[model samples]
Target: MRYIAIDVGSTFLKAAQLDVQYLAITNMESIRMPEPLPNENPLVKEWNAIQLLELMQGLIDRQLASCPGCKGIWISTQMHGFIITDEYGVAVTPYISWQDERGLEYADKLGSSYFSALMERVGEEAWRRTGLWEKPGVAAVGLFHMLQQADSGMEIEWEGQGTACPVSMNDIQTLGSKRLCTLGGYLIQSLTGSHVCHFTNAAPTGLVDVRAGEWDIDIVRAVGCQALQFPRIVVGTDIVGHYHSRWGAIPVYPDIGDHQASVLGSLADATNEAIVNMGTAGWISRVSDAYHIGEWELRPYFEGSYLPTITKLPGGRNMAVLVRFIADVGQSIYGTALTEDTLWERLLAEADRAAQYFKTGKGQSSNGQLHVHVGFYGKQTVADKGAIDNIDSDNLQVGGLFAAAMEEIAAIYERNLYVLATAGEAIEQITFTGGVIMKNAFLRDAIAKAVGIEAVMAPACDEVFHGLLRLALVSEGLYASVHETREVLLQAIL
Candidate 1:
C-alpha cells in the first residue's frame, strides 16, 4: 500500500510518498512556507489563510499527479498557531502564527500584558491542566488579546503608538461564534469538511486538558473565549474523512503534531530510548505510558502514550549565531566573504580539528579553557542569555570557539537527560533526528560523548513521513497497534 504524508511546518510545507511494504519514503518535496503578510508591527506574524490553503492544495495536486493510486493521506502540522473560521469553516481572520507576539502588548489601563492578564485570570492550575508553560504566543493568549480588543471597541494595532484602530473589530467580534483550529485542521476541514483535531495538535493550544484529552471548560471560560467552537478531539489514526483527489477519495487522518510525528518516526524504543531532535530549535523527548508533569512539558502521543519533552533548547539557530559572527569577522578583517555552505564547511573543519583537544585526559591548555553557554535564545525561561567564560588569546579563534559552543550544547542535552533520569525514566540509548544532528557529525559525536550512552541516528531524515506511514498501518488495520507497527517497520528497515 502507498500513503501520502504532508507536514505543514512553519518554515516549509513538506510531503512524501510512503511505501508501506518497504517502509520507505520516496518522491519527497518541500516548498518554502508562504511569507507572513507584511505587518507594520514586527511582533505580528500572520499569513493569508486562503492563500495558504491554495498552496496546500497545489502541493497535494502535484503529489497525486506524480504518484497515482495513493491509498491514504496523513498530516502533521506546526502546533500552537490557529485560524478563526466561521460556522461554515470559512476563515474570518488571518492565520495567526505561533511566532506572533501581539499578546505581549499591554491590554489594560493598569499596564498588564495580555499574556500576564490571561495567566492571572486562568491561574497556575491551567498550566497543570494543559501541560504547557505560559507563553505569549499561545492560541488562548492570542484569543484573549482579541477579546480585550473587541470588548473595548478598539482594534489595537501592534504598532508602538498604541492607538485604537477599528480595522479588525468585526473579525474580533466574530470569534465569539467562530471555530478555532490549527492550520492543519483548517486544511482538513477544507479537504474533507471534517471539523475535528487530533489530541496531539489540540494540546498545544493551551485550551485542551492533556490528561482528559478534551477542552478544559474552566480554562476556556477564564480566557473569555467560552463561546468559540473547538473541534472534536480525536485520538490515534482515526480517519476524519476522505479527500476527493483526482486519483480517488483518499482516507484523511486528523493532523498530528509535527514533534510527535517526527519522534514516532524515529523508531525509538519507548522503554529504553530517548529521542533528540535538533533542527532550527531542539527537543529531547521520551515516550511514557503514564503522565508526569514537572520541568518537562507533557504532550499526548500515539496510542495513549505521553511524551515528556524538554523543548526550545538551543540548536542550529544558536550555532548559526557563532557561524555568522565568525563570517563577519573574516569579512571585516581579511576581506573574505564566505557563502553559507562554505562557512559551515570551514566551521565543521575547525570543530573537527578542535575535537582532539576535547578528548578526555586533555588539559585545559589543550582547549584554551573556553566554556560557552549557548542559551542565546533562552531555554525554559526567555530571560536567559548566553555567555562565554574563560576565553583567552589562545582559544579565541573559530576552531576553539565552535568547539566550545558544540560542547556547551551537548552539555545542555546531557543535563536535561539527567533531569529525566531523576524523574525515574531510565533512558538506555539516545536516537538522534532532524537536519542539524544528521548533517553535523562533530555535534553528534559531542552529544554522544556527553550523554555517555549508545546513540544512533534515525534511519531516515524525513521522520514525519515515516511516522505517518506507521499511523497509516494502524489506521488501515494492517497492524493492531503502534507498537506492532513499529516492530514491523523496524524489521523492514533493518
Candidate 2:
C-alpha cells in the first residue's frame, strides 16, 4: 500500500509519497513557505485567503499529477494557530501561530501561585516553567502573562488594538485547549468543509482540561478564550472522513500537533525506549505512564494537562542565534549565509571541535565532570545589539564555547532524564530526530554518552510528518497497535 503525507510548516509545505509496505519515499516535493501577512502580531495574518487557497490547490494538484502512486493526502498544519468560525462554521479569524508572541502579557500575570497550582494538577512542565525552563515545544507562558498584563490596563499590542477580544465579561465556560491548539480543524474545514483539531494538539494548550479530557468552564475562565467557537476536539488518530473527487479517498485522520505524534510514533518499544527531536528546536522527552512535574519553583506546565513529565533545558533553539551572530563573519570570513544546508555544515564543523574538546577532557574523569545548558531563547546565543548578551569571548571562544554549550546542554538533558528515570520513567533506550541531528553528530553522541543508552537514529528523521502518517494508519487499525505500526514502519523503511 502507499500513502501521501503533507506537512504545512512555517517556512514550507512538505509533501511526500511513501510505499507503506517498503516504508520508502517513492516521491517527495516541497514548496517554499508562501508569504505570510507580515503582521507584527505574528499570530494574526495579512495573507489573502483566496490567494492562499489557490496556491495550495495548485501545489496539491501539481504533486498529484506527478506522483502516480499517490494514495491519499494527509496534512499536518502549522501548530498554535487558530481559525475561528461563526455559528455557520465560517472562519472568523486568520491563523494564529505559536510563533506569535501576542499572548506574552497574559503569560506573565499567570502569577507564580496560579502557575504552580496548575503544574501540580496537570503533571507536565511544558505549560509553565520551573528552574528557568519548561518542557520542550511548550509555548512561552510569558506570552500569556503579557496578555494578562495588557488586559489589566497595561500597554497592549494586538492585531486589532481597539478591536475587542473574543472573550466576554460573563464568559465562564470549559475549554479543552488555549492558543493555537486548533489549527488542524481550520484547515480541515477549509478543504473538506469540517472542523477537527484533535486532542494531541489540544493538550499543549494551557487551557486543556486534562481531568475531563475536554474543554471545561474553569479552563475558559482561566485562559479567557472562546472554547465554544471551535469544532469538536477529536482523537489524534481519528479518521475524520474522506474525500474522493479521485484524489483517492483515504481516511482523513486528525493528526495531533506533530510533536505528540512523534512521541507515539518513535517509542522504541512498549516499555523503555524514548526519543529526542533536535530539529530547528530540540526536545528530549520520554514516553511514560506517569506525569512528572518539576519542583514548585521550577513551575512547569499548567493545570489540567498530561504530557512530558519533565523538560531538559532552554538552549536547544539558541543555535539559530549563534548562527545569525556568526553570519556577519560567515559572509565576511566563511563566505556562506546561514541557510539550512550551510548551517548544517557549520554545525558539523563545530561538532568536530566539540569532539576535540571532549578528547582534551577525556581521562580527566573527576575533573571532566563539567556541565552546561545552552539556551537560545533569551536572545541569540551570541552578543548582538538586540541579542540578550554576546557570548563572553574572553572565556567562550567560538570553538571552546561551542564545546562548553554542548556540555551544558548535555548536563541539563542528563539532569532531567536521570531525575525522572530514578523516579519511575526508567528510559531504557532513546532515539534522535529533527533538523539538528542532520549535522550535529557531536550532540547526538554527547547525549548518548550522557544518558548512557544506545541512541537510535530513526532512519527517517522528520518526526512530525512521519509521526502523523503512522498515527493515522495505526488509529485506523490498518495496523493493530503502535507496536504493529512500528513493524510495518520498519519494513517500509527497509
Q: What Cα-based lDDT does every candidate model obtain?
A: 0.82, 0.52
Write the residue-wise lDDT of candidate 2 on 62-99 in tens digits: 66777665556666665445543444434334444555
Candidate 2's error at 66, in angstroms? 4.4
Q: Model 2: residues >4 Å from true position, as ranges?
A: 34-36, 39-59, 66-71, 87-90, 106-181, 244-251, 290-316, 332-347, 354-373, 379-396, 422-425, 475-477, 491-494
Candidate 1, run of 10 with poorest lDDT: 158-167
- Segments of candidate 1 deviating more than 4 angstroms: 156-167, 330-336, 357-368, 378-383
